[model samples]
Each structure stands twice: as C-alpha cells, then as structure tokens.
Target: MLDQFLWVIFPYLCVAIFIVGHIWRYRIDQFGWTAKSSEFIEKKQLMVGSILFHFAVIPVFLGHIVGLFIPAHWMSAIGVNEHIYHLGAVYVGGFFGIVMFVGMFLLTFRRINNKSVRKLSSASDMVVNFLLLFITFIGIYATLVTNNIVTDFDYRQSISVWTRGLVTFSPDASLMTDVPLTFQIHVLSAFLIFALWPATRLVHAWSLPFNYVGRSYIVYRKHKK
Candidate 1:
C-alpha cells in the first residue's frame, strides 16, 4: 500500500500537476514567463555558474531520457552489453553530475551569500535553487557511491522498467520496492522538483525563443548629441 502510493500514485499526481500548472501559468501569467536572469546585476558569478550549469545539465537531461526511457533490451539489441553500458553511464554521467553539482553550488551560494542577488531573489527562487543543489548532490552520490562503489544494483532492470511502465500507464510499484535507499530518495526528490517546476522560474525552459531565428533585426536611428 505504501509502495503503491509512493511509486504509482505519487508519480502520476506530480505529472498531472506539472501539466496543469504549466498550462495555467502560461494562460494567466504570460508576461512572467521568463528566467528573470540576474546577469545584468552580477555578471561574473552568473556567467561562470550559468555556463557551467547549462552545459552540464543538457547532457545530464539527455542521459536521464536515455537511461529511464530506453529499455535495457534496446541497448542489448544494439550490441551494447550491460557492462559496457554501465561503464559509460557511470563515467560519463558521473563527470557531468559532478560538474552540475559545482555549478549548482556556485549558483546557490551566490543567491544566498551575495546580498545584492539575495535581495532580488524571491522565496521561490531561493527554494528552487537550493532544491536543485540538493537534488544534484544526491544524484552524484548515487552515481558514484551507490551505483559504483556499493552493491552492483542494476537499476535498468528495476528503476528503468518502473519508470517506463509509468509512461505507458502500467506502473509496477514492486519494482521500486527493493532498490537502494539513495535511488528512492533521488527519484522522490526529482518528482518534487517537477511538481514545483511550473510555479518557479524553471518554466522559462519551455519558452525557447525560436521566433528569433526568422524574425527581422532591429533598426536603430541616431539622435543628435
């Protein structure tokens, strides 16, 4: 019963809220749909942290898609054995995980320690930043310690299968029942982040400025000095 709620009911609830919240936010607060970047306020720390965070997060996001969505059988079908895949996932994923951790740390530090940045930060902004930092830290620990140094638990067979099942609307809660505690925490934290995403500045991620690619350039007229 507990497993059902945590693994099955909780995930679906978060997804539903994620979808509905984004739609409502888009319709009611279109003007607020921005990253609200503070680069103009403090360029140095923002530049370093933002670059590192974005650079590391893109590959990490793709890694999650591949790891959770793609089945183990698919990799085996393509001649990639379990050991090979695990090595790639551990090394590559671990590297970017560490990078992302650093980036998040810097960003969170700036947000909290820098009076100027902190003054401008809303409660939601601080919450999101610290939450991301926590998530990234746990992810790195799971990858390096649980997946690498500890018992050889093949999450592909359990967590991956369970995640795909959720997408296909046939989640099996038992699959997540015996996984390492770190992974369980990581997954739960991730869902929490997703639930908060729509209400936070994270919504700017979906607002790509594709129109800029085809739009005409701005023209400026000189004024007499």
Candidate 2:
C-alpha cells in the first residue's frame, strides 16, 4: 500500500517538477548576462570543497544505482551475491554519502555564518543548501536504519524493481509502501531535490567542464607602434 502510493505519486510529482523547474529557471541571456568577475577568487578553498563534494558523493550515487536499480534475479543470474552488493550500498555508498553530508553541511553553514559570505548570499541561496541538507540527512538515516525494518521484504529487491521502472519510464509504485516509512521519506526527499535542482546553484552540476577548467593563461606584452 505504502509502496504503491509512493510508486504512483512521488515519481510523477518529481519528474514533473524537475521538467517544469528547468523550463521555468533556465535562461539563455548570453548577450546581457553579466556579473563582476571576481578578482579575489579563492582557488584553494573552492577546490577543497569541490573535491569532497565530487569524490565522496559520486560513488554513493553510483552505488545507489547498482543497489536500487538492478533486479536481484538479474544479478544472481550473473552470479553476484546480492548481500555483497547491498553492503557496497551501505558502507561504500554510505561513506561517500556521509562525506557529501558533511561537506555540504560545512559549505552551507559557512555560507550562513561567515559575514562576508552571508552578506552576499540570498534567500534562494539558503533555500538551495537547506534542500541539500534535508535530502542528505534523510538519505543517511535511510541507509542506516533500513536493516531494522521487518526483515521479510528485502530493500534491495524493492529498490531494484522501482529503479528499473524509473529507467524504463514505467515507474513502479508497488515498492514504495512495502519497505518502511523511513524509506518513503528517502524517496520523497530524493524526488523533491530532483524537482528543486534547476532552481538552485545546483544547476552548476550541469555546467561541468567549462565551469571548473582550472587552466591559467600566460600573456606577453607586445608594444604596438
């Protein structure tokens, strides 16, 4: 029942919100868009934050994909132990997940508490980071407490079925309620964050290569007569 409702509701809600968010927020104002280029950019600090964010969270995302999205039968047919895969989901994924949790929290709080950074930030800025805080918190909790739920229904199985549906665009609602309330919160938070993505600095995620190319150029002065 719970799974069915989540399977039906959150998926559609999240996807719709995600689609509409990009449409509403994405702007192409190359001609007029301008911000004062910072002369005091702190390369070292930004690099530290980015490293933690990417390295820690990225593997977690990948692990979730494997654990939640792939069918147990498919994995077993290929001779992989589902428990091993699930452990990767908890320990490996959860490690980076925690890294992301801590890294993002530090970034968020730094933005809030630092006077210079605070003055320059907006309500939207707080909103964006706060969203991340909620999502990651719930994710951590879900990963930790899932084993405590009645051990009858396997989380990996339900997650796999749901994820497969997510990939195929059919979206299974059956898995949502069967798991646990904690699981539902994780699902809802995930969809909400996805829906909220385009509206926040989170959009930086899409502008990868050009955004962080750390290249420096040398200019030589030549006199023009």
Candidate 3:
C-alpha cells in the first residue's frame, strides 16, 4: 500500500497538479512568467553557473528520456547490451551529474552571498535551488559510488517499464517495490520538483519567445538636425 501510493497515486497527483497549476498561473499571472534572472546584479557568477548547469542538464534530461522511455529491448535490438549501456550510463551520467552539482552550488552560493541578488531572490528560488542540489547530489552518488562499487542495478527493466506504464495509464506499483532506496528517493524527489514547478520560476520554460522568429527587424533612422 505504501509503495502503491508512492509509485502510482503520487505520480498522477503531481502531474495533475502541475497541469492545472500551470493553466491557472498562465491565465491569472501571465506577466509573472519569467525565470526572474538576476544577471544584472551579478553577471559573472550567473554566466558561469547558468551556462554550465544548462549544458550539463541538457544531456541529463536526454539521458532520462532515453533511459526511462526507451525500453531495454530497444537498446538490445540496436546491439547495445546491458553491460555496455550501464557502463555508459555510469560514466557519462556521473560526469555531467558532478558538473551540474558544481554549477548549482555556485549559483546557490551566488544567490546567498551577493547582497543585491539575494535581496532580489524569492523564497521559491532558494527552495528550487536546494531541491536541485539535493537531487543532483543524490543522483551523482548513486551513479558514481553506489552503482559502481556496490550494486549496479539496471533500472531499465523495472523503473523504465513502470514509467512507461504510467504514461499509458497502466501504472504497476509493484515494479518499484524492489528498486533501490536511493533510486526511489530520486524518483520521488523528481515528482515533488515537478509538483512545485508551476509555482516557481520554472514556469518560464513554457513561455519561450518562439514568436520572435520570422518577424521583421526594427529599423532605426536619424532625423536631419
């Protein structure tokens, strides 16, 4: 029953909240949809942290998509065995995980240390940063230490299938019953993060300026004096 709620009910609840909260925020507070960038207050730290975090996170995001969405059979079909995949996952994922952790730490430090930036930051900013740090650090530890030294649990068979089942509206909570405690915490933390996304600066992700593309450029003219 505990696993049922954590794996099935909680995930669905988080998704529902994320969707509804996003709609409500967009309708009632569209103007507040920004990352609330503090680049003006301190560009150096922001640039270094933001760039490093984003670059590293892109691969991490893609890795999750491939790991969770793509089945183990698909990789095997493409000549990638479990050992090969796990090796790559550990090496590559660990590298970026460390990079992302460092970057997030720098950003969090900057926000806390810089008076102007700290003043400009909201409670949500601190919450999100702390969550990211926790999640990323756990992930790195899981990949680099736990998986490498102790047990290299291939989540593709269990966690991946479970996630795919959730997408198909057929979540099997039993799949997660045997998953490692560290991985379980990581998954739960991710769901919590998603639930908090709509209320935080993450809403900016939905408001990309894609409309700016294919538009005419502004022209400036000097008046004769």
Candidate that beats the other on lDDT, 1 or 3, i.e. the better one: 1
TM-score, predicted candidate 2 vs. hidden true structure: 0.78
As a whole number from 0 to 100, the lDDT of residue 169 in candidate 3 is 99
lDDT of each: 0.92, 0.69, 0.90
Tens digits of per-residue lDDT for model 2, 101-165: 87787777666766766776667678877877887888888777666455565776676677777
Q: Which is superior by TM-score, 1 or 2?
A: 1
Per-prediction TM-score to the true structure, in the order listed: 0.93, 0.78, 0.91
Query: What stretches of model 2 exceed 4 Å from their correct place?
Result: 1-6, 27-47, 166-169, 210-225
RMSD to the native, candidate 3? Answer: 3.5
Backbone N/Cα/C clashes per model: 0, 4, 0
Task: Identify the runs in model 1 with alpha carbons over 4 angstroms from their true place.
Answer: 213-225
Cα shift from native, residue 117, model 3 (Å):
1.3
Rank candidates, TM-score, best first. 1, 3, 2
In candidate 1, the residue pairs with backbone N, CA or C atoms under 3 Å apart (3 or more residues apart, or in different chains) clash, namely none
Model 1, range 1-225, lDDT digits (tens) per residue?
A: 999999999999999999999999999999999999888778888888888999999999999999999888898999999888888788999999999989888899989888988999999999899899999999989988987655668888899999989989999999999999999999999999999999999999998899999999999898989
For model 3, residues 1-225, the per-residue Cα lDDT tens digits are: 888899999999999999999999998988898998888689999999988898899899999999999998899999999889887798988888889999999999999999998899899999999999999998888777767555646788889999999999999999999888788889999999999999999898777688789788999898999
Candidate 2 RMSD to the real structure: 4.8
